[model samples]
Target chain A: MSAVAALSYLVASVLFMSGLKMLSSPKTARKGNISASLGMLIAIVVTLTDEKILDYTFILAGLLTGSAVGVWFALRVQMTAMPQLVGVLNGFGGGASALVAFAEYIRISGDASLSVWTGDAPLDVLITLVLSILIGTVTIVGSMIASAKLHGVMRSAPILYPFQKQTNAAILVAAIVLGVLFVFDPSRWYLLVIIAGLAAILGVTSVIPIGGADMPVVISLMNSYSGLAGAMTGFVLSNNVLIISGTLVGTSGIILTNIMCKAMNRSLANVLFAGVGAEYDPSVQAVEQRTVIRYTPEDAATILESAQSVIIVPGYGLAVAQAQHALQELVNILTAKGMLVRYAIHPVAGRMPGHMNVLLAEANAPYDILMEMDQINDDFQNTDVALVIGANDVVNPAARYKKDSPLYGMPILNVDHARTVMVCKRSLNPGFAGEDNELFYNEKTMMVFGDAKETVTKLVQLMKS
Target chain B: MTEGLMISIYIFVLAAFVGVEVISKVPPLLHTPLMSGSNAISGITLVGSLIAAGEGHGGLSVILGFIAVVLATVNVVGGFLVTDRMLKMFKKEPQKKDQRA
Candidate 1:
């Protein structure tokens, strides 16, 4: 039976691999997801039928209740709330790992007759158990804080004070000490609980110092931690399927974290600790009084009509204004008029990686016209009009040269290079990075002040007329 | 470490490399789905959760294992369903037959 179970797990792991491989392309992504779910189902069924099963009531109830809640969340979530949803699911994954490790500890410790550490061929199960609990507890707490920030339940600003770094270090040190003590003496199981407590505190301290703009990096890192926690649990239980899948998730998270960090031209450490956008720099003067031409929808429409090529750049404000559908309508009208139109997506354009793409896809925009930053950036120079809707920092030219600016050294859309730049924004305020956009004041730029949805809708209506 | 532990370590190292290689090629367009999908795979801890819960140690272990099973199930089920929902949104270009000429 164990052999059969092992073979089934091998099959399940293969399914997960192929599922992930298929996810690399849009045409097969949905099928890939389905394939992975089938793998999960197979693993679950085989595990249940294995000889370890002494009863089934608790397992049945848990499966039913969890499925109901999971379906509820998956069905009702808005596309705009995707980051929070993912964060919550990550928390659950980590919480499960911690709980499973804790249960294993209680099981072994309750039966005093069996000594786990005495054999010359030690499994190091105790050490893995401690690590699983530690990493998993941290992931749960960190993911909750991140989700709260994304959902606007908590202040999105970085919560910092004197000695914050030192305080976090102390908590981590305390957790490690407790973990070591538990590993050495299995009788000291209470120490494991304390270690989890310290780990939970460390989770809060580490995540609270990151501001909302850096959430993509924080979430990716937490996702990695969740996977590491699972891997740790796999070692505790001697489970290969868990280890392989967990390592895969851990690697994916690291890759994404690296990509997001590179896009902002910031290292992972700076994103995690520097708290870059904590507050507006007081030294930067209030340049709000600087004047710029504010164009109406009608004038913007006229300029857009004559443009040979246009690149649409979107940001979080597009989600806030719920203007993706309106913008897509406008794109259809423009495309029909024999004008070349495409979207320019900065890697960090929104709160999460690929956030703008999800919103645009939800609005029914075809995938071919959506262009990543590296792909569409150069085309902006030859383009007649660069229409920036609800985006600021990504299009700011200061990133290229303003050394004193927080956004400096970061890659930005070359919107300023277009023959004409049309910006539709609610106001002339600086963006989330607290850096003023000089592109708004450029002679070639025209600022259309209004809600993004209203402005884009008017443009669509005008184009239709 | 036991031979089993050593083998597990080897598998972990090799799988990590495979993950980086396989995931690196995923286009930015499908990143959200990629994230959610991999998240579901991490829920493989559900296997451990089942063993623990079904063992029915008749005490705190059962309670903890039950909760673990529920949470792991939510991670697996919710992650895949949400990934599918998001991927379903990514429609390909409408057939460009009108411009073929």
Candidate 2:
């Protein structure tokens, strides 16, 4: 490699690493992203300039088009869809890497001189070719499945057969046997096709057994799979840049997948094979003796006006209403009155981690005031009022005690612990996990029936008046 | 083919457009969970990097492969850690039946 090319790669790598590191914290994630992209740009430019390939025009055109689309997506994609977009982009990356590997294999295989120099004219070339093809093909299929699941095209509930475990095992055995055969005799091109088919089936089956609630974790796991596939293909081609980049992606994906599994308090094996949280028990006896207290916007305003301390607990409802900005306005109003105001954010409040924080931050809510469940749950005792906006499962009391409930053992924000719990919701419907919320019937709880944005806006008006 | 490249670009652009449309429609209450869930997708980069590394040949390739492995590892580890920490906050215990007022 030329010294200049090496220097450029080094710089790009450093940029990528630093950008990834900064991405861990939400505050600096945007900057981290920019830095990483810049590194990638440098790498691409340097690679193109240093290579002897005569097709500069196509390369430049591709770069321009890709960048334009990337920029537009970056500018336009909503924060909520960011995950799906990320998934698709990841799939693209895998697809791109796989294509490069295939191209390399094809180039080498067709050239007699290159094949002779590399080794056994057909065998060595074929081995590399098959490995690249397998890995790249798998990455493409697996990522697509993951993206689909995330986007909700497929049912989020686990699809289980009577002998789910045995079926998965059988598929695995077949794929392994085929892989082994291909390794021994590289000429059997059909073996590679079989392996790809099996891998694709594995991807689908692996994700099929996971529930919607566990999608974030599943997506993370598939992401790791895609990366590993990429790195393996890089090895097949003996490309230093591809190998390094692919390995970085694979390891990070696995670690993230593990983190997601742990977030759901599940093991990787359980996530893959246990089919937990998939069956929604509709027969669980909900306590019907308890009475629900209803409050109009004006009534809610009165409660807020008298409260010495108020905490706003946000959930998926708040996100649905896009009320972060209005909610921030309410917080400002309450805080100005010397009321202790804070946001109680559950870990899995929306559909993913830190979903509330991101939305609130977009509305310019002070990061300091956005409290995690552990940080603010205890404070609910001293809190005169807890305003729940569009939250259900996270605040549902059943998650704590109802053993049959899908969310049983799942930690919840203690909004129910507050002296006066006011929930702003459109209806008494259960949450995504499809379980009724007992917190609604608490004596201290009052339902402020309306859209979260409208309710908050009305409450603000009432407070001002 | 260059056509594939063009198609990929179009897909992303469409994806972004769809993303904005959906976010606008989602209730504020769902924001937290949605964001957390979506962030999980970022983990895909780790997978890509790892596969790329495994294809490397000798010397600098090996070193680069190792680096990719480490970076991907960190991303996966840190991401799950944060996610788990978040999920723990939602598991609530049942209150005593007799304590109900």
Candidate 3:
């Protein structure tokens, strides 16, 4: 590589690092993204110059088509669909890495003069190549399934059959064995295709058993796999910029995954394998029979009018009903009436980490008022009204002491400590965790049944009158 | 071990540490954007795709490279653009007072 090209890559790597560092605060996040994109632009242009292309037709066509589609998707996607969009994009990145590795293999193996085994440690290159293909293929297929599940194309419930884990384990082991065999005898290249096939199956089987509520972890893990695949391809191509940038993304995903798992108070293995939210248990019928006072939105508004303080808890149901704007309107009205109003965000409240925040931000809610669980958990006790909007399991007090429940160990918001709890939900059904919420049955709790958007809008209207 | 592989390993290890350090500082408020933004960075695989496509390899290699390039570009462009869109919505507070000064 020329000195100029090497120096440019180094600069690009630095830009990526600085950009990520700047993301720590919202004030600089937009600028950080723009700078990182500039870095990408520099890397692409420098790479084009270095490769000495004989034909620009394919490159031009690919670039133009990709840009148009990418722009359309980015511009057209609703805030509620962000997780699905990210999942699809992650899949593309992984698929690209796998394809690049395959192309490299074809380029080298086809030319008798340039042997793949010519390097000092041929095994190193071969291993990297196999790893790239395996990881990349797995990431792409797994991401597609995950996105589909999130998009409602597949059932949100965990899909399980007998001996599922054992099957996934066997497929993985077989793929590894084949990968080693192919490394020894590169002649039987068909092994690569079989490995990719196994990877695709592994992707499906692995993601199918994870329920919708656990998508935050799955999405983050898939993001990590996509980056690791990129790094493996970097090793195959011996590209420093790719290695550095890919590793950065890989670690970022790993960190997010860890944080999500911690917030849910579950181990990574339990999240992946326990299939925690698989079925709505029959035991919930007992809780359903327990009597609870059902309140109207008018009543809720009256209750709110007298409250000195309010903390709103949002969950996935908010996104499903497209009620963020309505909820925000209610918040505005409450604030205008001289009541202290704030939003309490549970980490795993919605479909993904930061899901509720994104939806609320889209509704133009001020970032200052959106509080994390730890920041506001203690204040719930002093708050006059804890308005639960389209939320469930997160506020369930049973998690504090119910050992047999799936949510037993999971950290929940301290909404039960509030003076009065009002819940707006579609029905009395349990949440994705399938655990009946004890908070819903508490004496202080008031259940308001209806579409979240309609109920919140009614509350706003009533308060205005 | 080859000197090139050794250097790449060192770079990889150091970059991993840098990744953890920088990412840990990102608060949960920006976690969604962080996921999408770093996803764009992962599209660096486009570099390899470009090389594969531009080099006059074979029909199959060129085709594979072309598809790879397109996918990587989508990952790059979509990931960054969507992240920017989401981040744009995250305001510290509504613009009520002019503080241009």
Candidate 4:
């Protein structure tokens, strides 16, 4: 309400804009974050100073406790668990917003003077409150399920039952019906509570049916919903900063979701409604195999030493095997030999977007040599060897030809185009797509069965000799 | 619609546009940190939480308000700290970990 408060919010919005712009570039991202964080601190301080407080006890308690726990999670969580951590944080944001909106509703309804529906207190508040509670509660439970799946607390695969889609639709309808009842009689607080309960349950059911391959999209979509929930809370509180920042996050999430979907050449509807890669029929025969030539680390080293250029294709296997450091050392040794080595990264190479880039960066791999799917796809033709490390579906040749394959039409790294391809995998098990990789049977491809880290380590040792 | 409602709508529309513009330029590689960063921003519920906590309503409102405050604060702090951790790994210079040097 004060001019200074408004001015600070304006400054905060500007800071948020600049911060997001800086995030687009790697070099200025840290400064961008610090600037945004400073803005947040200013916004919070300004709100506290303006709002009449009976006591700062609860505020201070929340701050200290939350910050301590937050610092612990941030510092203690492994890089491999980043997706799950992000998922959990998104859930926390939604739950917080939902609670805040409902609390505001309770406070207003208790105030006899301000609870009027005609003049000062209108239907708008009711609508916003219903929306905030609905979206926020759903996002919270949905994100929790997502995080659980990612953490292996539950199966990463989509857990399906009879008429799962129909059940989800029914829950959504019930929540909406309850929301309608609350909009008319805002004082009927129990109706709102029932709606929140239904929305929360809806969240769990909706996300539970989405398979692992689609997790990145589902998580990002939930992030968008949390943003929308925050926006609804901003409306209820009539806070400009909350509204602007919430909108920013919500829009950003939608854009991210779209990008992830586009990268996989899948539609958002297809991703949400039809869970791909979740149901793998083991009954399908993988009998197209001709010959799988086996090789040892010594042979791998010899091939690498003879090659003029090599492309390293990494995947979830690298993360599971913790082979990033060993692979980096191998790249280092290969670099020393005057051999050209570049990394060809798939869009969905790891568990999520940017996963491969950050994981490899943690291993101190030079970022310049790491190329995106489109950036280095063409060069695979001229490369002497493609070292497929703990990778499968991304480099699977079946995507190009087999119409009946689950991976059909999905763009993949053309590792088979290279003169020779060496695959390091544990067994002949299928990938997330639940289809056998024909590239594993390619004449130019050699199956090097072992843990990626140990195999890469052995290759490093052999290179030394 | 009421004048107050109209103002809220106007603010909401303008903010949504601003948000889209701000987020449009972020690159693909930074998507993870970007998601984390925006998640922190959405924790803007902290403002509402502060108000709810100070309102000193009935027992339920106060309790709910306190829980909300804690959760929002967790979101704000956890989201930013984790994002910062991730971004720190993406430095121009790599760390030296000489295992078998």
Candidate with the greatest DockQ versus the true structure: 3
Residue by residue across A115-155, what tens digits does model 2's lDDT show? 22233333443554455455545555665666676667877
What is candidate 1's TM-score against the reference?
Answer: 0.96
Q: lDDT rank, highest first?
A: 3, 1, 4, 2
Clash count for candidate 1 is 0
Q: Whole-model Cα lDDT per candidate?
A: 0.88, 0.58, 0.89, 0.83
lDDT of 1 by residue, A1-465 (tens): 489999999999999999999988898888889999999999999998978789899999999988998899999999999999888888899999999998887666655233343322133888889899999999999999999999999999999888988898889888888877776677777788898998899888899999998999988888888899999998988899999999999999999999999988899888888877787664564636778997899999899888889899998899999999889888988988999999999998777788889989988889989999989888888999999998988888899999988888999889888899999999877887888888988999999999999999999999899
Q: Where's the lowest-lDDT run of ten residues in candidate 2 chain A?
A: A112-121
Candidate 4 segments exceeding 4 Å error: A111-120, A286-289, B98-101
Candidate 2, B-chain TM? 0.61
Tell me the deviation in Å of residue A385 in model 1.
Answer: 1.1
DockQ of each: 0.63, 0.04, 0.68, 0.65
TM-score of each prediction: 0.96, 0.73, 0.96, 0.95
Across A1-465, the per-residue lDDT of candidate 4 in tens digits comes to 789988998898778778878998888998888788778888888878865567678878888888888888888998888888888888888998899888887677755233443323467778888899999999999999999988899987877788988998998888888888878777677888898999989988898878887888988898899999998998888877888888888888898788778766689988877767666776564455456888888888888889999999999899999999899889988888998988888878766667788788878887777788889999999999999998888888888889887677888998988999999999878888788887887788889998999999999899888
Interface RMSD of each: 1.6, 14.6, 1.5, 2.0
Q: Kindly provide the TM-score obtained by chain B of candidate 1 when compared with the true chain B.
A: 0.89
Candidate 2, residue B92: CA error in Å? 31
Candidate 4 - CAPRI tier? Answer: medium
Candidate 3 residue spans exceeding 4 A from truth: A110-121, A281-283, A286-288, B95-101
Docking class of 2: incorrect
